[model samples]
Target: MALGLFWATVSLVVFLLISTADMLGYLKPKNHFDVDGKTVVVTGGSQGMGRALGKLLAQRGANVVIVARDRQKLEAALKYISAAAKDVEKQRFHYISADVTKSEENIRIVEEVTSWNNGNSPDVVWANAGGAYSELFIDTPVELMRSQMDLNYFAAAYLAHATLRSWLRPASTKQTSEAAAAVAPRHFIITSSVVCFVGLAGYSPYAPAKSALRSLADSLRSEVRLYNGYRRANPSKGPAADVEIHCVTPGTIFSPGLDNENKTKPAVTHILEESDPRQTEDEAATAAIKGLERGGYLITTQWLGSLLRAGMLGGVPRNAVFMDTMKAWLTPVIWLFMQPDLEGKVLRWGEKNEVKLPQ
Candidate 1:
C-alpha cells in the first residue's frame, strides 16, 4: 500500500507538470483574423447552416456573398443576410446562382465574385454546400451515391481550390495594394458532418464523402504551413500569407436538410443520431465560427460531438486543452467497453428485423 501510494503521488506530480507545459505552449498568441470589412463567400448559402453562417458573418461586418443554384433562394438568402449585416453600406451582401457541384461553375463563381468586388479576393471562403441521404448501401442507387459525392466532396474541393488560387496570386497583380493586404490570414472552412468519423447504418454513402474531407483538410493544413514557411523566409513579401483550413464536424443540426433526411432516414440511423444532442442551425454556426476564431482546425459544435472527435483520436488537429486531451485519450478506453453493448444492440435490431446487407 505504501509503495502504491508513493508511485501515485509521483505520477500525479508528473502529470501536472506535463499539463502545465502543454497549456503554456498552447497559450501563445493565436491569430484570430478579424472579419470586419472582409469579403466572405459561402456556398449553399440559400438555406440551412449556410444561411445561418452567412447571417452570422454579415453580423460581424463582413461583406457577404452567398452562392446557390436557385436564383429565388439566392435572392431570399441575400435579403436575410443583408438584414443581419452590421453596416448596410460597408458590409455588403450579394448572392450568385451557380451549381457548386460543377467544377467550372465553381471557377466562374469565384471569378464573378472577384469581379463584383473589383478583383479583390475574398478573405474567407466557406464550403458549406453538402447534402446527406441515409439508406441501406444496396438500396442506395449508383447515381445517388455519385451525386452525394459530387455535392459533398467535389463541390467543396472545387471551391477551396478556386478560392485559394485566387488568394495566392502575386501581390503586384492585385487590383490594389489594399487587396493584397487582405490576402493574408485567409480562412477556408468546410462543413463536414459528425458522420465523417462516427459512421452508422444507412450512412455508407454519406460517411465516406465526409471522411474524405478530413484527409483534404489535413493535407491542406500541411501545405499551408509549408507555404507560410516560404513566405516567412522571404521577408520582402511582407507578412506570411497564413491560410487557415478548418473542418467543422457538427452533429445533428435541425435544418431544412435534416427535415428532408428525417423523411427517409432509417430507424437505426435515427437511433444512432439521436444519441447526440441536436442543435439548431444558428447554434451550430455559432459554435463553428467561434471554433474558427479560436484557431481550431477540427471543430465540433456539441459536447457529444467533441467527445466523439477526441475519442477517435484521428489525425485531425485538436484544440490542445490539457483536460480535453485527457478526456479524448480516456474516452476511447471507456468506449471500448461500451461499444460492444452498442454493437450488440445494433446487431440484435438487424437480426430481429432480418435487415438485408449489401453483398
Candidate 2:
C-alpha cells in the first residue's frame, strides 16, 4: 500500500511537469508572431537590443525601419539590417533620426513611418529607446532624476501613445464588416527591465522609471482589447486592425549601454547584479522574440527574470495561466529566504562601507 502511494504521487508529479511544459509553450506549435512581409519599426535601433531586433526582423522578411538620434549609426545599422533581408531585392529598409524623448518627435516619427509605408501604419512598433543612470537615491542630482524619467519612461510612453493613435485611425472610406474583421493585428511592444520587478540599490535614478513601464504595459494590454471589441462591434467605422500590447523584461543586456552604465553603477549594486548571468543584446532580442511569438504578454528573457516576474505579477495577464500560477505560488516561499538574504547583504554592505552622501 505504501509503495503504491509513492508511485501514484510520482506519476502525478510527472503529469504535472508535462502539463506545465506544454502550457509554457515548450510543446506548442509556434504559428503566431509571423512577420514575413510586414513592416516593423524599432526605436533605439542605432545600438543594443533595438539594432538586434531590427536585424532579426529583417531576416524574418520584414520591411524594417530603425529609429535613432544618430544618423551615422542609423545608416550603418540600416546597411547591416538590409543585408539580412529574406528577399534582398523585394524587401525595404529605412532609418529615421529622431529624439523619441520629445512627445512631438514621437508623433513625427509615426507620421514619417506612415508616409514611408505608403500611408499605412507599420504593422509593428517597438518602444525600445531608453537609458540607465545608476546612483544612490539621495546622491542622484535633481536634474538627473527628470532626465532619467524622460529617457526611460516618457519616451516609450510618448511613442506608444502616438503610434497607437496612428494605428487606430479610421479608414478614409468605411470598411465592410467582413473587411474590418479580416484585418491583421498590430502589435506595440515595450522594453522594460528585470530590475523593474526586483529593484536593486544604486539603480535609484532608473528602476522606478522601468517599473512604470511595466505598469504601463499591464494597463495598455487590457485597454487595447476595447478597440479589438470596438472593431468587432462596429467594423465599418474604423480601427481596421486589432491591437496587442506586449512588454519584454530583459535581464542585463551586454551592450554599449551596459558599458556606459557600469561607469556610474555602485559597488553594492554590482554585487547584487552578479546573480544574473549576462546576455548579449542579440541573445536577449532572440529570447524576447521567441516569447512574443508564443503570445506572452509579460515576457522575460531569462530564468531569473522569469522568476522575478512570477513573484510580482499582480493582476497582469499570464503567459501560461497554470504555469504562472504555480510559479507565483512558489516565488514567495523562495522569497521568504531571498528577501532576508538580500536585505542582510545590503545592511552588511552599508555597515562596512559606512555609506554617506554629501550634505
Candidate 3:
C-alpha cells in the first residue's frame, strides 16, 4: 500500500511538470528586428532607462533622437550617447526637448526629428517616459490618477498616432511622385511594466494606467497588422510595409528612482538598498539594444521569464493579472481553504519569487 501511494504521488508530480514545460514552451517570446543604423526616437531620453536605451542604440550605429522636457538633460544624454559611440564622426544623434503629454508638443517633436532625418520620419519610437506613485487609495489625491493616465497612456498613444500620420504623409514636392512614394521602416515601442499583467497592493493610480497601456498595445498591434495586410493586398491604395508596433515590459529595474523610493521609506530602506544587484547604465543600455535588435514584442528582464510564461498559459488578459492579485490579497482566507498546501509549495519552489506589485 505504501509503495503504491508513493508511486501515485510521483506520477502526479511528473504529470504536472510535463504540463508546465509545455505551457512555458508555448509562451516563449518570439524575436522580430535588428535596429542597427535605424532612425530611433526615445522619449524621456534624458535619464534612467530611457537614457540607457538611447545610449545603447547609438553605440550600435542607430541615429538616436533623444526627447525630454529638459533641454539640459537632453544635451547631457546626447553627450553620453555620442561618447558611448566613441567615433564622433560616425555617430548620428539628435535631441528634441518637449513634453509628450500635450498633443501639439508631441507633433512638434515628431516634426523636429523628421527634419533632422532629411524629412524622413523616425524608424523606431520608444515611448518610455511614463510612471506613477504608490499611495493608499483613500489618501491618494484624484489628480495623481489623472496625471498617471495622461503621462502613461495618452502620451504614448499620441506619439504613435503622430508618428504614423507623419509617415503616411508625402515627404516633398521636389522628388517625383513615385520616388516620394517609397516608404521607410518604422516601429512604435512603449515601456510598460509587469504591473500591466499583475497588480499587488499599493499601485492604485499607476496599475490601471499601465493596464490600459497593455490593452492599447495589444489593440494597436492588431490594427497595424490588419492595416498593413490591407495595404499589401491593394498596393496602390495601401500603406507601405515599413510600420510596426512593439510593447516592452521590463521587470523592476534597480534605477536611481527605485533607489530614492527605497531611501525615503524608514524600515525597508536598508533592505531595498542592499537587495539591488546594480547593473551599470551601460549594461542596461546594451540589453535594450539586444532586445530591439531581436525585435522582441514584450521585452522583460531575465528574472521575469518564468512569471510571464505562467501568465501566458492562464489565458489571462493583461488586466486580469492585476485583478487576480487583488483577489489574492483580499481573500487570504479563501486562498487558505482552496489551496491549503500552496504556501509551503510556493516557498519551496524558489527564494527569488516574482512578486506582483501593488496596484
Candidate 4:
C-alpha cells in the first residue's frame, strides 16, 4: 500500500510540473533580446564569435562597441560590423583596443562607453575575452593556472564589476520612478564552455576557470534581484531598470582559439571530447542570441550542451523548468553507464603514457 501511494504522489508531481512548463514555454517572448536602438559592448569583439555577435547585433539595429587588444583586427571588425548596420544613419559602430585582463582598463572601458553613449551605461555587455590551455593538472604549472584564471574568470569578473557598479546606483532625481519602471531590462552575458559542466582528462587548467564563470553568473542572477525588488518597492526611487544575468555555454567551435588549443591538446583529451557538437562562430552566436531572446538564464547552443547542463543543474535559474527537470531526472541514469566508459579511457591512457612535468 505504501509503495502504491508513493508512486501515486510521484505521478501527480510529474503531471503538475509538465503542465506548468508547457504553459510557461508557450508564453516566452519570441525576440526578447531586443537590441534595437540600444548601445551594446562586446569584449573579444575583434574576431571569431565576438565579431559574429557584433555584426549580427548591428544587423538587428544596435549601436555596437567592440573591445579587444588588437587595433588592426578591431578596426577591421568595426568596418565589417558598421556595414551591417540596419540603419546607416542612426546605428553606429566603434572599436576599443584595450586588454580586458586589467581591472583599471575595464573601468576605463565603462567610462569611455558611457561618454560615447551620451552619458548612459550600455544596455548590454557581453564578456567573451578568454583563452584556454590544456594539460594534465600534474603536468600544468602553477603560473599557467594563474594565467588561465586571469584570462577566463577574472577578466570577465572585472568587466562585470565595473558594469554593475555603474548600473546599480541611485536613480537621478530628475527622472521620475514611473519612467524608470517603463525602461527595458539590461543584459549581461558571459561565455563559458561545455567542459565547465563536466571536467575532462586534459583540460585541468581551463575547465575550472570556465566553471567559475558559471558560478558567478548563478550567484549574480539571484543577487541582482535585490535591486529589482527595491525598484518594485520604491518604483520612483529604485534602479534605472531590471537586470538579467545570463551565461552562454557554447560547444566546440572552429575558431582561432580552438586552433591554438589543439596544438597542445593531448590525444586522449581529444578522445574524451570526440562526442561534443561543433558549431561555427556565426552558428554559436546566432543560437545563443535566440536563447537569450527566449529568457534563458543558462543558455546552451546544441543538444549535447543541453544534456550536459541538465545533469549538473544545481540551484541555477531555469530556462524551461519542466523540461530541464525531466532531463535532470534522466541524465543521472545516462551518466551511470557513461561514467565508467570515460573513466576506463582515462585509466588506459594513463597506463600507456606519462605527462612530462614542466620544470
lDDT (Cα, tens digit) per residue for candidate 3, span 1-359: 99999999997787666556544654334444555667889998888888888777776677888888889888998988778773567658888888899999999988898888887777888888876566545556688778878988889989988987876543333343354245444788877776676543356667787778777877877777666665555555555444676666665566765564443222322332233245555555565555655555555544333244234423323322332343334454544552444344434433655543455
Q: What TM-score does each of the candidates earn?
A: 0.88, 0.94, 0.71, 0.91
Using TM-score as the yardstick, the better of models 1 and 4 is: 4
Question: TM-score of the candidate numbered 1?
Answer: 0.88
Q: What is candidate 4's local distance difference test score?
A: 0.89
Candidate 4: give the clashing pairs: 177-236
Pairs in clash, predicted candidate 3:
32-295, 33-293, 33-295, 200-357, 200-358, 201-358, 202-358, 203-358, 203-359, 204-359
Q: Model 2: per-residue lDDT, tens digit, 219-255?
A: 9888888888887888888686889999999989999
List candidate 3 segments past 4 Å from native. Answer: 1-32, 169-184, 260-285, 313-359
Best by TM-score: 2
List model 1 lDDT by residue over 56-155, tens digit each: 9988889999998899888988998899989987777788999999989999988998888887777789999998988878888999999999999999
Off by over 4 Å in 2: 1-17, 20-26
> lDDT of all predictions, in order shown?
0.82, 0.89, 0.66, 0.89
